[model samples]
Target: MVRKCSVAGCNNTAGLHSFPADLKIRRQWLHALGLEDREFPPRAGVCKLHFTRDCFSNAMQVEMGFSSQLMLKSDAVPYANVTPPARTPRPQRRPGASTSSACIQLPLSRDVSCQTDPLETHTVGTQLSLKTLLPHFRSEGVQANVSCKDFGVGMSNADPLGLSSTPVKRPRLDLDEQLEDDALEHSSLEEALKGQDSTHDPASLDSSLKSADSSTPTHNSKKYIVYESCIMELFNVCPVCTRACDVRTQRLGTFLSVKQWCPRCTFTRHWNSQPVIGSVPSGNLHLSAAVYLSGASFILIEKVFKAMKLQLFRYETFQRHARAFIEPAVIHHWKATQDVNLQSLSQEEKVIVGGDMRADSPAHSAKYGSYATMDLRTNTVVDIQLVQSNEVGGSCHMEKEGLKRSLALLESRGINLDCIVTDRHPQVQKFLRERNITHYYDVWHMAKGISKKLEAISKQKDCEKLKKWMKSIINHIYWTAASSTSEPERIAKWTTILNHVRDVHTHEDPLYPKCEHVIRKTTDKSKWLQADTLAFYKLEKLLTKKRTLKDVAKLSPHHQTSSLEAFRAVILRFAPKNVVFPFIGMLCRLYLAAMHYNENVDRPLAETEEGVPLFKISFPKSRKEECRVKPQKTQPTFGYVADTMDLIFEKVFVNPVPYTDALLAIPVPEDLSP
Candidate 1:
């Protein structure tokens, strides 16, 4: 039987609301219905027509067409006028006709009677009731909650719910098998609920149901290189009318759109492959940002896309994105990171940093020079300053200007420097002296300069014997710097090279009176540099050079700028010298490289499965054909790329005006061409 409004005048049954369980609310509802004098029947309800529009809690949603159901607010009472209809008497049951034995009563606020033949099972409303009853049945006894009596049949309690009391006779399965079955059932129920929930859109329900039926995992939201043919398959037939559709596809860089119209049923649909942020497609913006952050060349990536017949944005579009969003994010992130680093450094008594400048090209022809400073203790790039040749008056002076800018930045952050290590450039030395800053020469830089002179001398006729001692001389420079604690000790150890090459271990200097190595008789006399020979004379003069001695005395006893050199190599990946970039573009790329270096510089070396340290043999060009073993480090991660992407999408994309303003504030130099 259909439910009707409990109000006497109303016969309407749709959109009915059950009376609230609270006694006071129920009494008020009955009073409004003019039935307070009579006893209210259990499970009685009032049609929505009797309630005013203000009674609905979702009144706005209903009015805006977002919802079809009218939900009454709590404490709401029916006050709308009801017109009385002709009264009809209840139907009388025929004699000898018994109620259906399979009838089941539902546990609802309003009574809903269901009946069926005893031989046929009634499945309607069973699943919903079981969902509500399963927990109670599990906690208590299932037999006590559901039984033959609930099916309108009286039976003994021993055979409750008409289920067999004895356990199954089949052999028990393994624990894994039981768990697998339980997991499958749990997942099935979860999928069923996801599909059946009314709040979910039909498109989502369809996708969820399809996922439940498939064995493979979904990758709809992940990045993929999809083919045009594969995408066309989805639009071949209209989903609404199940007929042939005239589908049109449009492409804008990495963005794609599809429109389908069915000729038979006039069905139409439009879809885009990527979300749009303002006027730009999100995919296009992300691609441009990723390319810049990962130190990838856009031209190379575009070529790859072209070879694969894939769609991609133009270089101009990439530059536009960089200027508008990616560049500002880099500047913002770098400054924020630098501020934190500086604050941390400020707590220390004295910070020893290694500073260096890298030119975009060799010699005076270079257009740009970037100065990078690293905290020696942590081996992290703390700050980088980019200088254009034009700003510094000449390419030769860019390095000095870049270093000055970096020092100024560090000074502004209140970081106190105990000492700094750099190459012995005359301009740099003079500048540091004027400021009274304690400066030392990087051992590698001094050693490299000495090695070049020795290499050239060894190439001359009769000076070929010097080649045998070149490697030993370079190694001695590092040893002298590493072993000595003072200028006297460093000079004494360094001068020992001249005596040691002539098969002499005794030295005149009291700081290093004798060689530290064990005395041994030489089996191959040819290896030793004999006194008074041309090779020996050239080696002594070069080793005893006034400038060389001065640089050796100030060799950095602590950290060197090798890591800074490594950072310059990293910059090559971001801003290659072969490719020209605008001033801001070069600065942003330098920032990106610095971030990448700072994040991964201290990564641990890779290890084998047995916990043994791993190493790889490499033949470096500088080492000639000789192979050297180096530790194989763990894979470098691009976490900074993700951070940059987040910054762009969450902050920059939302309100780019502030970020653009910051980018615009940077002074970009005039183009060289015109």
Candidate 2:
């Protein structure tokens, strides 16, 4: 049956709103219609003509074509131009002739008022009884037959006072209750409909519907690797007719669409395995993002997919996605996070940071160099600058250029640097000196350099004894930097390593006159280098080299850049040197690596249920088969990936112009080829 407005004179059947179950709001609505004193039908509703436009929640959306329906606000009440219909006057009684036998008939369209006592007589026109009117009411689909004896009114079954002692049938007033039950039963269908828009394309509509489905409280969103055969089984049979269906399947990369039609019942359905954004499926975009963000090689992933006969998008498609959405998201999120970190550091009086440059390739053949500057206090990467080799004129000069850009950015952001620790790069030293910034050399970089030189000398025929003290010499470099507070003390302590390696343990310098270790007799007599021998002479010359000593004097007394080195290793995972990338692609990958590193830098060591720290044993190539025990860190979280995904789908995908503009503002260097 069609629904009409609850107001008595109005017969409009469109744009109606149901009566709210809330008694207070319902009373207000009834009062507005001048029916507050009567028992209105529960199924009655008010049309939109009786409500003002401001009462709708989506009035603007509907007007602007963004929405096709008008949704009323929860507290809305109809109050516009509503008037109650005038009641018809009752006919005069015939001088009260047998009034006790008279009966009243109420119209089905109007409210009916019933009395508590069934034996009471209601008079209208003639001397008509309720028993005579009951047959007509039953014929009109109104169940109102009642017997006075059934109500315990002391009436006899022998038709006393013309009343019968039969069962009563009351009118149903459960229309609103049944509607509520139906709404509850089909709530999921309502949710699905709410996500659809007639104005959107099928792909976007699918995306919206999928998003809505995943947002439901019962939905547990997870990704699974499904095979084609497994999916085909679901559409092989028709759900309506329980017969075979003509199923047509289409595959685009990781996206699948199935169309099924049943010949018997003419039932059909078109289903999409995953939502899409524009022509690109969400799975395809997400897969590209996951590989890039996690530093996994797409080619390797493609191989895995091929091995399993799984369809995947091409490399060009992945590149397209990266250039359009993934890269911009990475850049946007990194800059946002970096600003927060720098702002926090700017509040401090003195900020000490470690700076380092990592090349895309080893030696001078590198095409890209990324300089990462980290706040030593927190061990979090504060900034990253990617420099193309051609932009700096050559690969060798990219380090200085990257450093210049990073320091310039930090300075503009008001980061007051007390000092910076870095590898002993001559250009970096000169640049910092020119700027009057205090610069210290990382002890590890200096030790690694000295160890390489000593290792080379130990391989010589006459200087073979230097091999015995190589480890001790490297350890002394770290001890000297850690123990000494001044440059003179550091140099003094470092020179004593020469004496300690030989039979002598005393030094001529007053700052460090003797070895700190307890005096003990040597177990291996041939291990100690004798004074004036060729091996001792070579070792002494290398140790006291003028430049080496100069580097030693500036060894960092506090924080080191080992964390920065680890971040470079992370960069390898995202943008490896073996695979070439464009300027923006490389830069974005660097940002992704930095984000990953900063998020997990402070992860605590993994521990067992008994609170014992865990460790992993690895045989590094450099260790020559000797196993090194390293602390096992707790599993890292990919919250940044989730955040970036949200940014891409919710913000960037909605309006990509701004993110693309921000990306385009960066000065990309010309291609090196031409």
Candidate 3:
């Protein structure tokens, strides 16, 4: 029969056993400390009130080293004289039936109210004897802490109770299955919103999202050929040919949509891709464009393309279409605007033109070869020719042919002719002499030559004398005037050094006469004429940047080839890092990439993409300064055609003779002679 609980507001049944007064009060106290799960000995148990209140002191004593069996016989044992109740047999359930069961059972020694057992000390007899009332309270309040809907640990499907049905199964997948799944999901989304408003079309929205993604790479190739052709044919092309609204797939609000774009024009919002078959090219299959782009050596350029959500296609159909219709039209347009001026310019500019060749070092240095030219006066490169030079002489021939072509172009236009300068490269000099091109030795080159000689001298037995003699000669040449009026004094300075060295040591050469003449002469025509003292200072400045002589020598070639150095920096900033294929198209792309060097593309203020220029900024050095007498605008003075001509033009050595002009008729510095 049920008996009401003596505790206030606790009307639940007392069931078979009831705790007496003191034990009930002690049980209440232990329940507050959450140690109410323990039960007293059966013969010593109290009624329900005393069982819940006073049982904790006995449980605490057991926890404090009193054994349960000993506590059963101790003074804390209630109803020590009463006989223990006989235990009931546990019910058995079928295994399969248990699987479907939604039951949460806390251990007999666990508390229902306290979720956390900071000490795990909940006992059976302390709070209310669960063991004594097991038949009555077994299912009641047992699942109170757990929820029915919780998908507990390891479970893949939701459980009716707050526990796992079974260990969660990892979805087993094959490569094909994974791909198909992705494709199905993507296509399903595309199909769902297919007929929505054009403004909210799924494909159009998807394209816009892709454009947003593609803004980071140094270069982006959204529409290789077919798409561009379709755009031009379908929609009127931009006059500037900068911007086009080509929609690519992007998702917004769970719909695939398109975004119209123009690379030349700035737009505030994304346009929808017209899925009308022609928006993209017909018979053009989309392959992994991302894979092809990843193969590029220029990391930034690849990233830029990726950012634009563009893909490259090497399809035969696209290539044929580009060749048949697009290329011809583009070429025609380019020719028509070939003379258009794209750069700002000023009059009577002080331009310093420099050129250097970069060829793979013996096929052993493992380096790509190219020739580049820069205007030091403005720090802007005007030419970069990528011609292969390999172990096979074919590459060399190609390089020579390329150089010849460039020289011809430059000669066609009057550029870099006033006071050209270069290092003492025999091949370059040979090329220059044949063309009657007036040039000078870079002052830095001359100083380095002197410095190298001095360093060698310092290693000799007669080092001090030789070093002093070398210094005097360098100072005399460096400080000497270029005018013919100072020729006699220059000759006297030359003679003094030569005589001193001859008297102190003996050295012989068959070309002594030619050498002596070089020693005696003071001509601006010599390739090794000392330039401004400032040039020597710059060389020294560069030398001091390094620690050892080897480092100085190793880096010295780059110093001489400063044009190539500048070009390398610009290229690195924009080009791919790994470029294995030497295709002409890629070369053209490289040219475009170089053209975009240092240009800042326009971007919105809340820029989500990094490394994209919000607006274009021209190369700073493109323009010349205003002359003292005549004021002029700052920009490229010559139009694009003329600029191109200036870069490739070399009046010297358009045609080479075998014997006469190819010889070194030029003299060397006074110190090097004899």
Candidate 4:
């Protein structure tokens, strides 16, 4: 007999007590009936159907040091009127009955289909309650005291159902015992299949299965490196001669290469690109590329190699690489400028040109002098000529024939220069004047020469006050040329400085007759400028000096070679006075520098919406009264080199061999040495 369920509509037996011991599984039964608490004194229980699947899972929940008591669900109808069957006691077994005793002590594992509570921690059996049989279960070495903590969480991996977590005591196996156990297992399986499978022998089948198991290996999932299968062979044909097939090779730096070759060739003419001992290129080892890329000084590169125990090439090799790679990169950029700046030649039928020359060193002795001619409208070098030794056969003139050569080259290119501005080099002035072309002395150069003279005068004890006006005098030379329209006006504005420095503000010319800048109305002692003083008389004599008058009379009204000076500085970086090279090598370096300088000569350093180039004010620290120096915008080198490298790799570089002058079609420079 069984007690009826406490659930309102359920008539099944109350197998489970609807345990709400920890309230994990009790919420559903409580919510279904609107109740606060439940008590089990009345044995108000319900069947397992009311519990969720989670409550019936194999994992058992046991609170430490506490028994799990259960009570009926509130929604369960009262079963107080029903009576459960009376509990029965088991009959005692006979003494010395080992088999029957063992049966009674063993733990039973049963599924939930038997209407038993699978959630119960105790094992179930037929004819007795597990709690009453606990003593007998312990006699068989079953772990009655062990709880969930004793079994540990990993118990489920070994036995998911956790029905047999106890460690049973057993005798250790000897060699004979091991053989007996294995024979017993095999015999039992053979006996069952003994009467079946009459066509096959078990012994032969067993041997075949053993062999298959031994041959097949299990695979595991993991990441690993896979080496290449084999080296590629040119094969069948010999490397020295296509007629022969057999050849011997040796390994070189992980790759295969020919050790010996036929007498016809000098070096090893045969090699395999593949490695005999396979490996991958793992890191950056391009020393030459890294040297230029990081902008590290060559000495520092050598030091780094020494520190890292890496092999550094000879110093000449680094220089050769510079000529090989960087020089061409710069030339490529220059040629691009030539194409894009073609509009520069469209400014006039014959554009105003400014010519200048740079020597290896400024002295009596020089190995080379490079003259560059620039079109005034476009601030870019039209062409350059390199003169070795003394220019123009060591002629008795302060001029470089390199200019004449460069100008001639430009004329052949259909570029006609209307007028040229340069310092009064005797031959340069004579050459232009003889051609009947207008020649204007570069105003800045004239001003520099005058300032040098003024600086010497300012150093005199009585003329120390003239130092303050040195900058003004230099400024006045530029101001006069910039302010005057005619050559006569240029002379008038320039000569006015003698009267102006003596406090004579008024002038003869209509354009700049009166001083434009505000005058100081102070009565300081140094401000007491008078024409009768020694400083004034000395400055007057220097201002009206023969060289000064000659330069000012032909002052360039609106042109100067200030841009060329900036380009020469770039050339100095590329060619560098401290380094020496062959004559052709020197010229190529100059071409590289010219291309780089011309590319961004007019680009605004930082611009506004109006697109005018910006100016920066700088005070010269060296010169107590230095002339104003104009600023050139910095050209960005980022990506410029990379683009040039692409041009070299794609268009210029044909092979691993060094570049040749014959390939580029460059003419050798003339030797002017006596």
**Cα RMSD for candidates in order:** 19.4, 20.7, 26.5, 28.5
**Candidate 1's residue-wise lDDT over 1-674, tens digit each?**
78888877678888889889888988888788777635577768888778755576544333322224666767789854762422224234344433331122232221111121112232211112222211222111111222222211112223221224443232111111111133432353222222122222222222221122233212223467777777777667644334565665545678665544444433333445654333455677788888888889998999999899877877877887888789989898888888889999988999999899998889788888888889989989998887778887888887788789888988988899999999988899999999999999999888788889999999998899888988999999999999889988998899898888879999888888899999999899888888888888888888888988888888999889888888888999899899988888889889889888988998999999999999999998878899999999999988888877878776776667788898888877765557
Which structure is stronger by lDDT: 1 or 3? 1
Error of 3 at 344 (Å): 7.7
User: In terms of TM-score, which candidate is stronger, 1 or 3?
Assistant: 1
Error of 4 at 362 (Å): 2.1
TM-scores, each model vs. reference: 0.68, 0.68, 0.33, 0.52
What does candidate 4's lDDT look like per residue over 1-674, in tens digits? 46766666678773555435556445555555444455333455656555532233221211110112222333333232233422224446546433332121221333242233323242110111223322233222121222221111111122222123342122111111111123332353222112122233322322221111133211111212222122223332323223333333332111222212222111112222221100110011124434543344567668876786443455654565556555555555655566555455744587888888887876856677788888777787877777766435543332457767866666665665777888778888778777787888888777777788888887887888888887778888888888878877777788888877777789877756888778777566575357787888888888787777777878888779988888898887667787775675677667666666665666657665697766676676546565565654755553544565444443333332333443255555566543
Q: Which candidate order results from sorting by lDDT in descending order?
A: 2, 1, 4, 3
Candidate 1, superposed: residue stretches over 4 Å from native? 1-220
Question: Which regions of candidate 4 fall more than 4 Å away from where they truly are?
Answer: 1-300, 315-347, 395-399, 508-521, 606-622, 625-635, 638-640, 655-665, 669-674
TM-score of 3: 0.33
Residue lDDT tens for model 3, 526-566: 32313243333333343333232222221221123444455
Model 2: residues with Cα > 4 Å off, grouped in runs? 1-220, 237-244, 277-279
Best by lDDT: 2
lDDT of 1 at 309: 84
Poorest lDDT segment (10 consecutive residues) of candidate 3: 148-157
Q: Put down candidate 2 lDDT per residue, 1-674, tens digits, no spaces.
A: 77798787789888788988888988888887788646587578888788765576544323322223466777888874753432334335445334442223232232111111232342211112334322222211112232221211112223322212332132111111211122332352222222222233332322342442135211114567777667667667644335676665555567665545444433344455665444445677778888887778899999998998877877877887788888888899998998899899889999999999988889888888888899999999998888888887899898899889888988898888999999999999999999999999998888888889999999999888888798889888999999999998988898887778777878889888877789999788898888879998888898898998899899999999988988888888888788988889888888888888888998999999999999999998766789999999999988898888877766676577889999999999888889
Candidate 1 lDDT score at position 370:
87
Ranking by TM-score: 2, 1, 4, 3
